[model samples]
Target: MSDRAAAFHALHRPGRPLLLPNAWDHASAAALAACGHSAIGTTSLGVAAASGKPDAAGATQDENRDLARRLRELPVLLTVDVEGGFSDDPAAVADYVAELAALGVVGVNLEDGRPDGSLAPTELAAAKIAAVKAAVPGLFVNARTDAWWLGVPEPRDEALRRARAYREAGADGLFVPGAPDDAVGLLAAQAGRPLNVLHRPGGPGLAELGRLGVARVSTGSLLFRAALGAALDVADAVRAGREADLPDVPAYGWVQELTERFRTDGHR
Candidate 1:
């Protein structure tokens, strides 16, 4: 396996989950890297919105690749969120993932959520995972099922069934984004791979998640949304003659230094 891929794989320790923060652009990713995060994943929503496209609508294919190419230059491991692999054809999905692998992306989150708020057929989703694994054996594939999020009947059963199929198809991780706290352990016990749950505000904390046997906790779009909220809050505070409640705000030069470092440190 590629060293980066191996490193990323090793981070998924059950009961000692890796807290992965997702980023939208280079600056956001760089800031997280500078803060000592060992790895970062892209948020599909942030990437799509930044380019004025709808996420998971089969758009943003080029945008996702371009961002991955730039983010690969950061001093951290990179995993890309490729919604439905940007295509329904398994071969096409594998091709996209292979291109990403060649660009130094060590991991990918491929979901089965359709644009109409429905889960893709289990067989089709599993086939895509199999094709991606076949094409890029070293890349860590995190197969996500949106059963819980889409309000499917017997969401846990649906999620577990898909998770098993994905695991058999060689997925390295299983992600159930909207899984509830009570169901975490049951899912983790049967996922047969790393269990990745999306972290939410007022939900189970990282420590609590870790205790529930989750191997990964992804801040899927949460960080990007929080950043947006902070920006607007600061702007509103300035207009209202009130001090912003923001904390850990980086200075201009510190931000500028990141780009310089990426350039001079052989990112290109």
Candidate 2:
């Protein structure tokens, strides 16, 4: 198997679905890697915000590529969120995917929802998937469907239709961030490809997710938002002369240890 394909499988540990954390920058991705994560993902929201662009709007294509180029040197495997493939033009989308693969990224998440909160045509998305695969045959495409986000009947039938189309178009797997747990089996069975679901708060944990046949679990923007919120809370608490409620926070020496580890490996 290819290195990129192996990376994706390395993420899925049988009973344990890949608890993929989405990082915004090198430090965040490195911090997670230091904590023993085998792979990392980039959040579209974080990427867009970092580049001063709107998320899911075909914005920040260059920024995303730049981030991937930087993260390619890191120890962990990287997957990128290319919001709607960064353009409506299939050729442009394929070019973007090709760049990402060249940067050593193994996987990508391409959504089907437009910036206007409407769903793109299934055929359009299928074409995007095909174009990307043609541009980079070994790239793992996690075709994302946002039917639930667009406020429809959740479009199980439509979702299945799109899922099949993407699979035929060479998508390696499928991601439905807002997929309901009750219908998880149905989705997985129909997908033919592995079903990837977002890790929802107070929802099914990793074990429960595996039982539902979820092959991958993505912590979309939750980690980034939580980390940002924690930093702000601690700063605000200090201003109020109060102690922060941060979890067993890493110490200065422990953080230096990460740099040391990388430095020893010549990544310094």
Candidate 3:
């Protein structure tokens, strides 16, 4: 395996889940990397919304690749979220994965959810996984099932079934966003791979998730949403003539230094 891919794989430790905080753009990614995260993921929703495009509607392929190329310049492991691989064609998806792999992306999050709020047939999803794995053997393909997120009947069972098929298809990880904390352990036990769960603010915390056998916990657009919420809250606070309750906001100089470092050392 490639050294970067190996590093990313090593981060997914069962019972000691890696906290993958997803970023939207270069500044967000650079800020997260500056805070010392070993690995960083791009949120597809963030990318789409930033560009005024709909995510998972096959509108962000260029955005995904562009972000991947930029994020790869950061001094950290990087993963790009390629929603449904941007095409139904397995070979096309594999080619996209190859492009990302060439840009030094260590991982990818490929979902089986269609923009129409339905699940792709299991066979097709599996084929995409297999193609990606064959094309970029070193890239960690986190196969995502939206059964639970899409409110599919018997979501748990469906997720598990798809997980099994994806595992056999060479998925390196399994992601079930919106999976209930209660069912998380069951999925983790049966998936036969590292289970990645989206972190809900009031749901099981990281420590609890680790005990449940989750190997990866992704912020999954939460940070981007939180940032937006924070901005709105501050705007409202200012309108109401109340001080914005901001905490842990980094200094302007620090962010400037990060941008400068990127400009100077990003080439390395």
Using all chains and alpha carbons, the TM-scores for the candidates as numbered come to: 0.96, 0.92, 0.97
Q: Could you tell me which residue pairs clash in candidate 2?
A: none
For residue 155, what is the lDDT in candidate 3? Answer: 96
lDDT of 2 by residue, 34-151 (tens): 8888888999998888778888887788898888876776788888999898788999999988888888888899889998998898899999999998888777888999987777
What lDDT would each prediction earn against the true structure?
0.92, 0.84, 0.92
Query: Quick one: RMSD of model 3?
Result: 1.5
lDDT of 2: 0.84
Shift of residue 179 alpha carbon in model 3, Å: 0.9
Task: Give the per-residue lDDT of model 1 (tens digit) for 63-156.
Answer: 9899888887788999999999988899999999999999999999999999998889999999999999999999999999999999999999
**Per model, how many backbone clashes are there?**
0, 0, 0
Candidate 2, which segments miss by more than 4 Å at Cα?
Answer: 9-16, 256-267
